[model samples]
Target: MNEPLTRQPEPEYMDLDDEAVVYAEADFADVNAAFVERLIELTPAPGPLLALDLGTGPADIPRRAVAARPGWRIVAQDASFAMLSIARRADRAMGLVQSDAKRLPFAPASFDLVFSNSILHHITNVEPFWAEVKRVAKPGAAVFLRDLARPDSAERAHAIVETYSGREPDLLKEEFYRSLLSAYTPGEIRGQLERAGLAMLDVALVTDRHVDIWGTVP
Candidate 1:
């Protein structure tokens, strides 16, 4: 496998096009719902749990989580005000916060469960993400994080985009390709976890283009 691209953060303005993102992500609900199911099955937190959804773009995954696991109050945060605005309109049950993932506003050990999907690739340096996640999660808190795994080569990345996003709009397909190039491999993620002292979390390739890191906060 060829190396992943040098990390490049997505443009800040991309999040402002909430409608475009929502449309692009419409077909991904089932797979994301499965992510929630696997997370719950892996770490069964008790009811009335406090959950944090970091980088909850459009809050699609969190919305699924709330429906599948009732009484689990969720505070979903994203840096984008436009995205949060759309999420708030779509679902009022969960609290919405506009905040950076690297510097959360919550108190230490404030959450029983923490999860994020497809957000890792967006961070140019992932250390702060690991730090903040560890800081806010309560001891033994369930954690589930997932992101697209970078392909071995540009050709492979193109194939992935063609296979998965062939029917999507031109802009969405191009964005997906860029995201694939920007994603990290499993080994890279393991290294990141070790450096962040988060190696205790179980890391695995859960799909062709996805890697999941899940376990309790240790």
Candidate 2:
């Protein structure tokens, strides 16, 4: 497989528009809504929770969090202005910010929960991203991360992307394949969490493409 893109690309080049295509093709919006609700129900109440949605793509997860826990204060952060623009247009009440996952612009212990979905696989520096998550989250803060699990083969990765995109995404194929190659196994993810000063609480394969890992600040 070709090497993953080293630097962030323009949102248009990144095919932010394709998010809608993928969501529709996979019916992920509906599935994700239910999954988010279930995740919220499973989580213990962190009273008056201050939540951060890292890589808050299109703010779907953030919106779900807000709806599930009306009292929770949420900060939605994403690097793509196009994604953020779509999110802001959909929900005026959302607390949205444009920021990188690897370098969050927040003070230490600023949040009680940090969540990300379909985003971690895009990260080039997993260590720093997890470190920032740890740094900004309060002690004992909950963290929920869901990302594509490593594929068995590059062909599988490409097929999956094409399945959702409805066409070959040549511009992103290399990056997408690399992302799968770079993805962590359950054990590897847990190990990384430990190294990042987080204690793993739960880990599961949520679907064929997604792994759900939750942990807490050490």
Candidate 3:
């Protein structure tokens, strides 16, 4: 049996508008593009595939997924209504749904793929979140998770965020650090997936700070 360390209560302030959180500056476009390319490469199956973009901030992943594969149908869900509004306004292809990641409002085996980026660590309860993912995704469906790994110090995380966004995100800095403290190492992530009944396919450290864990539903 696998056990998660540092369990904490979910914070109310974590639900920020995706547009506000994501598009703090123009450079986020490049970041979004890079994530989109990675997601495309990870799942190359021809669509009419059903995709659920968990924490679909500003619906970037869903928008990019639709652009990459026109036959794909995306359910863009977020806990923030403001984010869903931004997503709906930005992309016509997305079906916007406001919901929490830990308790997805979908039927069992409802999706062919589930993708999330930089959102898992924000969640406080790992077990329920993974359980919901397993419930909603079909057997053999692909899951992609990208998040910051544990850092030696909060300063390192803040420095990276500052470098990426070109400004200090003071409000988000402490939260980011806390999230990292609770984040999974490569081994820990694979263990969590296996315990959640997901079959691991690949796990890679994309950068010193970021890790990508891909797996299939068993």
Best by lDDT: 1
What digit string (tens of lDDT, one per residue) describes model 3 on residues 18-84?
4355443334566678888888887887768998888877777777768888888888888887666
In the range 67-173, model 1's lDDT, one tens digit per residue, is 88887888999898777777788887769998889899999999999999888888876899899999999998988998999877778889998998798777777
Q: Estimate each model's TM-score.
A: 0.92, 0.77, 0.82
**C-alpha lDDT of residue 97 in model 3:** 86
> Any idea what lDDT model 1 has?
0.82
Once fitted onto the true fold, the runs of candidate 1 whose alpha carbons sit more than 4 angstroms away are 1-9, 18-25
- lDDT of each residue in 1-218, candidate 2, tens digit only: 56532333222213356654343233357657865775586466746788898877677777777777788889998887767777888799899988787888899999888887767766656799888988998887877888777766666767777666445345454555556666666766777777776655577787776798786766
lDDT of 1 at 22: 48
List CA RMSD, all candidates: 2.0, 4.8, 4.2
* Better model by TM-score: candidate 2 vs candidate 3: 3
Model 2: how far is 55 from its true place, Å? 0.4
Report, for all candidates in order, the number of backbone clashes.
Answer: 1, 0, 0
TM-score computed on alpha carbons, candidate 1: 0.92
